[model samples]
Structure formats: structure tokens, C-alpha cells
Target: MTDRRVQKTKKAIREAYLSLILEKETPKITITEIAQRADIDRKTFYLHYDSIEDIIHEFGRQETEALILHLEQNDFFDDTADMAALFRALNALIEANLELYQHIARTPSYAFLWGQIKDILKVSLTETMGERLDIPRAQLEICAEFYASGTISTYLAWLRGDLPMSDDQLAEIVGDIAYYGLHKLISPPKAEGDEG
Candidate 1:
């Protein structure tokens, strides 16, 4: 195929893949179906992607990398930054790609998508807290996972229209949760004899 044809075929394959994902779970989507939807032959789909998972993985990787670059360029992970701004920017990114994100959130491959998102969040957290905390990577990973899972779950709920908060409101809530510490929310009661 010519270079233009190759690009067009790949684009069609990606669109079909996304459409299929939105309509049904990833496991239920088939290469033959994707090819049919794309108006391409199965052979052409193979020439582009090894499998459906490969396309999903590549999409996740490209989006994750681009997000990382955008964050860095905007100094989003800077120390002493206004986290509300970071959250708002993140909300904007998700809003801009609402279809892809909503589809991913509802798919069976959500764990894979969540894992990629968590890893990126870990990077940002490490940058923000590494020097001050002087924590090992293992411990930092635990912190990252804790916060990332909460954030992802919340965002997924929001994407599904379960959460009624607007973007700025959600951002404020998430920022407070991140900075205010969870101990207060899940603290043990003090014994009567315990000192203040």
C-alpha cells in the first residue's frame, strides 16, 4: 500500500477499535469486525496491529506520553504549585477526549488503562514529594497507588455521570484530599487516658 493508504488504514482501524470498545467490552471485539467496520481487509488490519490489545496499548502509551509532556511543559508538577490548577488542567484534558476516556473507563481493559494512568500519577507524585520525603521507590509507589486509585475511581464515577460535581468543584475536592491527609478521615479514637 502507498504511504497515504497505510496511514488511512491505520486511522480507520483505530476509529473502528474505539467504536467497538464503546459498543462492547474489549474481549468481545474481534479483528474481523474491526476490519469490517473500517472497510478494510483483515489482512490490512494485521499489517497495522497484531491484535486489539496492541492497539489499545499503543493508544494508552501515546496518550500517557503526551499527557506527561504537557504536564511537564506547563510546570504542573512544580513544587509549591497550586494543585487546583493541575487538577483543572487534567480535567480539561479528559473533557477534550471525553469519548475515548469514557469508553476506556467502561471497557474490560479498564485495569490496563488504570495501571498506565497510575504510573503517570506516580511520576508526578515522585517529582512533587521525592526530595522532601526522601522516601524509597517502594514506599513512594504505595503512596502513589493509594492516591491514584482514589483519583481514578472518582474520575471514572464523574465520567459516568454518577458524580454531580463540576470540574472546578471536583478539582478542589481532590486537591484537598491529597493535601489534607487521610488520617483525619479514618482515624482511630483516642483512649480516655491518652494525652493531647
Candidate 2:
């Protein structure tokens, strides 16, 4: 376990970095600025992190871990997994960290952060779903990537206010898409010649 003081210092550094990133581009933010904002000297900052990017990478790692943990705790990978419940849980997790997600959404430079998280989820889903569904690895990988990318993209759109739907509505729509393909979720138009 990490020491409490070390954990506290790291939290301060992360908070300071996040605050600065919100105001300007990551490349423009300096270590000196972070150290000053964090109220720690350059040496102290170095002791905790190598550079500003290190803090960003660490934040991604921590968030990804939390996501995986939340999914597992909610039985997302179980044989009897409930698609609606899983999506609701996922939405709750995102809503809980709205500030961090909003930061990613508003910053074009942080786009990779979302990709990184999605890639991790894809890997996890591919492995677990492959075992559960008894599908080939290659097929499972493609399916997992498709689902993960689609779900994350939808959530990002919702976060950007482009979707204009409530959280529960968004979750239900996404859940339907995941549980049933577009063709199944939406009915096809009947031919003009067809009569009832």
C-alpha cells in the first residue's frame, strides 16, 4: 500500500494538473505551473511524476481500473448479465465523474484518453465474451471493438449535448443496440404491393 502522505501529494498533483489543463492546452502547461498550483516544489513534483504527461497517463490508468472494477462488481461479465442494468451502471459511473469526462470531451487534445479507455474495455470484453459465448477469438475481438467503440461514442455524444436525451433514455437506447442489432431494433418498411 502507498503511504498516506504520498497518496495525498499525488492527489494534489493530479488535481492541480486537471485544473490547469481545463484552462489551456496540455502542451502549454508547465511543470513549474503545476508545482506552484499544487504548492509543491519542482523536486517534490519530480519525486511524484516525471512530467505533466505522466500525470495524465496515471489518471487514465486509475480511471480505467475503476471502470473495470465497477463492471466486475456489477456482474457485467456474468452469464446472466442484464444489458439494461449494465448500461445503467456504466452511465452512473460516467455521471459520477462528469467533470473529468467533460474535460476530455471539451479538449481535442485529450481525445486519446477516451480511445485508451475504450481499447482497454475492448480487450476485457473480448476475453470475457469469447469465453462465455464460445466464439472464435478473431470474431470476438471484432465484435468487442465494435460494441466498445459504439457505446463510448454514443456516451461522448450525450456528454456533448448533441444527443439531447435523458440519462435513462440514453442508457435504454444503448442497451437496446447492444442487446439487439439495428435491424432487429427497427422494423423494415413493407412493400407497396403487400396487403394486410
Q: Give the TM-score of each candidate.
A: 0.78, 0.87
Which candidate gets the maximum lDDT versus the true structure? 2
**Tens digit per residue, CA lDDT, model 1, 5-57:** 88888889988888887777677789999999999899989899988888878
Worst 10 residues of 2 by lDDT: 78-87
Best by TM-score: 2
Candidate 2 lDDT by residue in tens digits, 1-196: 5699899999999999988887887888999999999999999999999878889889888877877787778777774255666567667777887877776877777778888878876876686677778777788889989988998888888888789988899888877877777866778888999876
Clashing pairs in model 2, backbone N/Cα/C closer than 3 A: none
Give the distance in Å from residue 8's predicted Cα in candidate 2 to where it truly belongs.
Answer: 0.5
After superposition on all CA atoms, how large is the RMSD of candidate 2?
A: 2.5
Clashes of each: 0, 0
Question: Compared to the true structure, candidate 1 yields what TM-score?
Answer: 0.78
